[model samples]
Target: MSQQQCACPKCDCSVDSQAIEKNGQRYCCEACAIGHTDGSTDCGHNCQCGK
Candidate 1:
């Protein structure tokens, strides 16, 4: 089986086995999923720089 990858363009984190789906796009987490919703770079978090 092939491992799935995060659909977030600003993020390169892998989704591993389970991928968070939002509007047909896959993400690693809720932050990433929501961030990419508006096509903005803001991930609603202050962990990673410019995430």
Candidate 2:
């Protein structure tokens, strides 16, 4: 069986699977999901860097 990995949508850190949450169609850890600094931080993906 494949294991589930919890990666932070912001920092891409290894999140504890138990602390992950599903918001809309995206998955994120509590901190990044709700704790964004005015939506800053690039998340290293392609999200607006809150500029």
Candidate 3:
């Protein structure tokens, strides 16, 4: 089967993947799916998000 290109639900960006389901739901990347939840944190062990 051929690959499908779709836009991210959080951010409008093209993503190529062959595993997309028929629901049209897709995530460009794990980072994008995570979203601003991490933005509040500093990405360090001291970050509250990690807690």
The lDDT leader among the candidates is 1
Model 3 / residue 49 / CA error / Å: 19
Task: Give one digit per residue, the lDDT tens place, for model 1 in 1-51.
Answer: 466766766565666557778898777777677774555554444335133
Candidate 3 or 2, higher TM-score: 3
Candidate 2, number of clashes: 0
User: How much does each candidate deviate from the true structure in C-alpha RMSD?
Assistant: 4.3, 6.0, 8.5
In TM-score terms, candidate 3 sits at: 0.34
Q: Residue 13 CA error for candidate 3 (Å)?
A: 0.7
Which stretches in model 1 have alpha-carbon errors above 4 Å?
36-50
Of the pair 2 and 3, which is ahead by lDDT? 2
Q: In candidate 3, which residue pairs get closer than 3 Å at backbone N, Cα or C atoms, i.e. clash?
A: none
Task: Give the candidate order by descending lDDT.
Answer: 1, 2, 3
Q: How far is candidate 3 from the true structure (C-alpha RMSD, Å)?
A: 8.5
Output the worst ten-in-a-row residue range by lDDT, candidate 1: 42-51
Predicted candidate 2 versus true structure: per-residue lDDT over 1-51, tens digit per residue? 333443443354433434446554233444355555556555434543223
Candidate 2 wrong stretches, greater than 4 Å = 1-9, 24-28, 35-51
